[model samples]
Target: MPPLDSVLAGFADAFTLFNLLFVVAGVAMGQLVGAIPGIGPVMAMAIAIPFTFTLDTLPAVSFLVGIMKGGLFGGAIPAVLINTPGTPDAAATTFDGHPLAAKGKPLKATKMALYSSVTGDAFSDMVLILASAPIAVIALKLGPVEVCALMIFAFAVIAGLVGDSLIKGLIAALLGLLLATVQLDPEQATPRFDFGYFQLYDGVNLVAVAVGMLAVAEIVRRMAEHDGRPQPAAVPQSEEPGARGVSWREYWGCRWTMLRGALIGTGLGALPGLGSTAAAFMSYASAKRGDPGGVPFGEGNLRGIAATESANSAVMGANLIPLLGIGIPGSVSAALLISAFVIHGIQPGPLMFRTQPELVYGIFGAMLMANLCNLIVGQLSLRAWSAAVKAPASFIFPAALIFCIAGVYLSSGGLFGVSIMLIAAAVSLTLTAVGIPVIVLLITFFLGRRFETSLSQALTILDGDPRALTAHPVALILLVGALATGVWMARRR
Candidate 1:
């Protein structure tokens, strides 16, 4: 258990009026932005990230974290009605959610989605609170070799989780890795791809890369569709007429699905490599397989919504576990969270537990409060935007792109940012079309340095001593565990 006094102190401080307001504004804005086609919390935060440069750490974190929670819920809106996913994580929701809409019960689907998502998110946050410390302690004992191996393990996991094809995932990973080389070389500080342009010295802006790949490419794809007739179909009830309310009977019945999904999500989130996509898929699979009531998964079942939403929301809390516990990010959202910590001059490695307990616990408290705020605000305002997607994509997408471009400028202050955006978008489009997954590349891109540094350090240690592995008990243990786990997983597959 965490120190009670410290936890209480941090929780109290985080609950102040200002932080509360930040939470509210962030969730609301996050939802609004998420409603726009092709824009998600990751890209939304990428654009907003530059603006937060001037704000204090708490407000900035509060604002960003709110979007993350709200974004999950926001995706449900479009998925339920228009069949478009606001965020990548919501892709699964559309499977059963849109089908539910076609069946003339959009309101019921939305309600079930909100309820299940909140439950899943809340459950995962609880898990995060309970699991982070033990993981952190384990992370502390990890040495260079273990850390490097962990990154490799993460790459494999993401590759397996994303897309239908492993080959595609590997391609995307390679693409991302290639792009990661655009800036200066880590060891020499010498620019490798500058080509005499000062803008290339900083390499590529992550914001530009994320926004371009996620939003711009998506926008282009939408425009290429048949006459842009505006994706359609959901029940009028989904719009939430005053008469509609969640049926008590349905709520009670589907509650078990929520519980199971949340539990699954929490467990996956604690692991370093498995993320939301995995959680959502696993939750839905488990829920379907464990179904005792003989509910059909694809035919607008409340149970389906429960499983998907619960796992999706739970993903946010679970993602943070690895980030806070070990310096590894299980998902893109956690990857961005790392940037937030960097901006605050806080490192997230093993020592972070000792050096920055307050921030760590404060983040936990914030996550807890954010999920509560999401449920409250989501339920309260669910009726307001339940109808058709009101805004045109032309307007929403342009504004999103503009914000992204401006954010890139503010963050990097050069045309290289814009170039990176176009390049990443094109690359992302190509990879997706060809069925390559980007996640494998994201892991390698992010953890490449750690792998390199660790490998070099271990080599140096080995040059002077042959018994280095024996000397470092923690490293030896980690190696054995990694090998065992890998073989077992491979065999199972």
Candidate 2:
């Protein structure tokens, strides 16, 4: 907590005028960038990073966090108006989000997105503040076998979420995991799929691949499908308060789903390495698996928006746990935030608690303010932004592709990144054409390492007893779930 004294001293400078300006500027830039497809927080942060060199640590970090908040919400913009995702994490948002807009409820969808996102984010932050230690304690007990099975469960759940077919989702997920494996073999130092390229020695960068497959690929596909059709102009619209007349009744109507999504996001977010994208996949899967009301998830279901938004939003807060408690960045953005700290000569970890309490708390306080800021700004502009739907996909898409190319290239200063983007986009397009679901692929990609690692650990701990999984409660539960899902699918078939 002692480090916090200096942090508090640092906080005292928030009123110094310059820091306040940076925060506003960062948020504005983030929103603008976020509205463009294929550019999210990562790209926003990269562009903003150069500017940080001109400022002190507190304002610099504050500015970055503010951009992050803006980027998170910006994804909803194009997704609702154009049906293209501004961020990879926002891909799921396109499902129900864009559909609702097409149905003349763009304002409603935007409002729901804001409320659900802020709700999930706020709750997750609270969990990080008050419940992270307890959750981490439980998470530490998980071993290799449990983790592997957990990955399998994640795979099953995600597969179940994508439309009506499990095969499609599983295939998509497996491909994603395979792509994820292209770079590094964690246990054995040998690369399995680098194809003799030194650029791949570090393995394929996830950001580049994600951008290529989701953002750039979408552009090419759009161009092929609709050649230069003029999109409609923006609609003049306004909302009651949220986005439409989003009533308290409506909010409470989906409260259970939102709360569940937040809980799942928080838990998954707390896991080291996995992040908001994974959180969205898993949360959607869980919603599908646990649904009692027979509502379709991918078809403009309000619950779907609530599910994805809440889970992904909560993931941000959950990512902070390992960062604050153990000095480990849970996601790339968190990793970037870590660098900002180190640049300022502030070391993170338990020692940080002793040294910079105010800075840490300042982050917490800023999170609250940032969410409020997002909500207020989101409500004000969500209606006007609906006009983007009027922009022809033909024009908007080329611009979107450019942004995607720029984002992937800027991730690292090399042309190889472009090559990877091409490869990923082609592969993703090929697979999707054959009916594979993206969420399925992403889950497999994320959990591939965790699966392999956990299985090996489980085996090691049990002296190679394959049946040892029966003794672990988590594993057993997963087994039961698999059995139930298999039986259900078979019956439906």
Worst ten in a row by lDDT for model 2? 234-243
> Compared to the true structure, candidate 2 yields what TM-score?
0.62
* Model 1 misplaced regions, further than 4 Å: 1-5, 91-104, 164-193, 197-203, 231-234, 238-243, 247-249, 272-275, 292-299, 464-493
Candidate number achieving the greatest lDDT relative to the actual structure: 1
TM-score of each: 0.86, 0.62
- Pairing residues by index, what is the TM-score of model 1? 0.86
Which lDDT tens digits does candidate 2 get at residues 1-493?
Answer: 2344564564466545566667766666566556765456665564454335446777888788778877777777777777877777777888888777666667777788788988998998888766544443454466656556655654565565554576665566667667767766777788778878877866676555656655566667767877554654533344435445567887788888899889988887876545677777777777777776744766667777888888888888787887676444556567557546644667654445545666666666566666777787677766544453345565666676776676567654567887877887888788778877653564355445545666667777878876776678787787678667656654664
Once fitted onto the true fold, the runs of candidate 2 whose alpha carbons sit more than 4 angstroms away are: 1-124, 127-131, 183-188, 227-229, 234-366, 379-395, 486-493
TM-score winner among the candidates?
1
Q: Total clashing residue pairs per candidate?
A: 7, 22
As a whole number from 0 to 100, the lDDT of residue 112 in candidate 2 is 85
* Candidate 1 clash pair list: 106-238, 107-238, 168-436, 168-437, 169-437, 173-441, 183-203
Least lDDT summed over 10 consecutive residues: which range in candidate 1?
234-243
Provide the lDDT at 272 for model 2: 51
lDDT of 2 at 157: 54
